[model samples]
Target: MPQHLLLIEDDARLASMVAEYLEQSGFSVNHCGDGLSGLAHLTQPPAGAAPELVVLDLMLPDIDGLEVCRRIRALPAPLSTVPVLMLTAKGDAMDRIIGLEIGADDYLPKPFEPRELLARIRAILRRKVDNPAPNGKTLRFGTLEIDRDARTVTVAGAACDLTSYQFDLLVALAERAGRVLTRDQIMEAVRGRELDAFDRSIDVHMGRIRAAIEADPKDPKRILTVRGVGYVFARQQD
Candidate 1:
């Protein structure tokens, strides 16, 4: 069965092109002209027809995309955890960073190739299927626990809220704990394409991941920054 995708884009021409292109690429797309309608569709889909991913436009007719993303993350689980790939026309790096900080799995600047979009969508969905921990093993550091099979993270028995990409990033780092990894190595491990341009996005994701799993995001111990080198996941944690 084709994976379902919801495209919340106000541009009719672009939406038509994207939906048609994605359909041709073996994805079933449901396009909405505005953010509110998109949110409504996500909140109440027809039976089990919920979308597996959302292609969200930064600028929307109503509520804007950032607010819409915030609302989606505020929704109940499964719904909140849906992968989001943001489309931005601003061509601004800050917009992309802000989007990642607020739970978007990935972002593509406007005037992008349809193939890249397809690849990004595939990458996001692929991460969901690829388990880093072999045999569904759980990686525990101090009181923090990551269940590879469940795709969940908990600290001190409390659930940690992380986007799909952020969860994968954490796993990539934790699996190689005590080993300093450069940004390229981390992105490579996550299988996220086009890293040279979007390397800062990794820092944005790591910040969010630390905010989720680290007791003190300001002074993170588990995930440490090597200052100009990259980052390292401390093997020994309190």
Candidate 2:
């Protein structure tokens, strides 16, 4: 099946153009002009299709774009892993930083080139699919069990739902627990080679992971910061 797309943009003209263009590109597109319906549409998995990517406008008629993004992030499973590319006029440094920080995989400013959006969509999808994830396949960390094949992780009998990226990140740290992995190293291991401005994205991803796995993200005992060097997944087998 072709990749699916959910577009939540309030502009009628923009929405129509984007939907038509994406459909021509062999992607099945669903367009919603308001945020409420857009979010409601995602609550249940589609009968036969789920979106592979979402293009969300930051300004919505009902819910704000950031809330929509967070709600999407809170979703359990395949949905959570779906890449979200934010649409906003706020494309400056701080806006971009916050978007990535708040869980968007990518953000595009208004008046963007259609071609650029398409390219970014491809990149995000490829990044997700090509990365090696050790969770669903299988993992054994004492009483901690990760079944990547099933997309489930359990620690001490408590089930924890994690995004695909989060699970993969944890697996990398678990595999090298006690070893310090620089930001660049972690990026290479989990998210491909380090990009010039991709460091903050890593921090956000790690923070999300720590929130899921650690009892505390503020002062984590599981994943520790090594001051200026990088991070170390605390050695648990001591």
Candidate 3:
């Protein structure tokens, strides 16, 4: 079975090219030219099946891609967790950061190679399938609990809503608590790739994770910043 992908891009020429290429690359591609229609396809699946991944364009006819991403994240479970890879013509760091902060799993600047896009898609999907933790193992730090087999995190017995990527990042950090891991190392461990120097996507993800699991995101303790170094998972979480 080929993985299904929904592409929400307004440029017909580019959409057609990408769809054809991805189809040849062993994916089933569904193309939507506008944000609303794409949202509909995802929220109200045709044939009772939603695409496994969404390749979203930042510029859409009906709505901006950021709004579309927000709306998707607001959808009910399973649907809300669907991985999003944002595509943008803008090379601005702010745009990429904003997209990731809004729950996009990854971002690719436009005029990108199809192979790179395919690789990114595979990387995100692979993270979803691969669980590195030993079965039944759970890591506990004070009130926070990370269950490997269940693929869940709970703070004070209440579940935290983290995306698969964020969950993986947390697990990676927790596995090596009390040690600072550079952004490059952390990215390699969780994303299976080196961090791009200009890409602050990791920081954006960290912010989201803090918001979900921290008592106060403003003063995070569980995942501490090493300041000019990287991040450390506190050995002592109170």
The prediction achieving the highest TM-score against the true structure is 1
Pairwise TM-score winner, candidates 2 and 3 = 3
**Candidate 3, poorest ten consecutive residues by summed lDDT:** 190-199
* Candidate 3 lDDT, 85-120, residue by residue in tens: 999876777888888898998888988999999999
lDDT of 2 by residue, 5-84 (tens): 88999899989998888888888888888878887777754776577888999889888888888888787776776778
What lDDT is obtained when candidate 3 is compared to the true structure? 0.89
Model 2: residues with Cα > 4 Å off, grouped in runs:
44-47, 74-81, 92-102, 127-136, 176-179, 191-194, 197-199
TM-score against native, each model: 0.97, 0.78, 0.94
Cα RMSD for candidate 2?
3.4
User: What TM-score would candidate 1 get against the native?
Assistant: 0.97
User: How are the candidates ranked when ordered by TM-score, highest leading?
Assistant: 1, 3, 2
Report lDDT (CA) for all predictions: 0.91, 0.75, 0.89
Which tens-of-lDDT digit does each residue in 1-238 have in candidate 1? 8889999999999999999999999999999999999999999886766899999999997788888899999898878999999998756887888899899999989999999999999999999889866754799999999998888999999998888999899999999999999998998898897577645888899999999988889999999999988999999999
Clash pairs, model 3 backbone: none
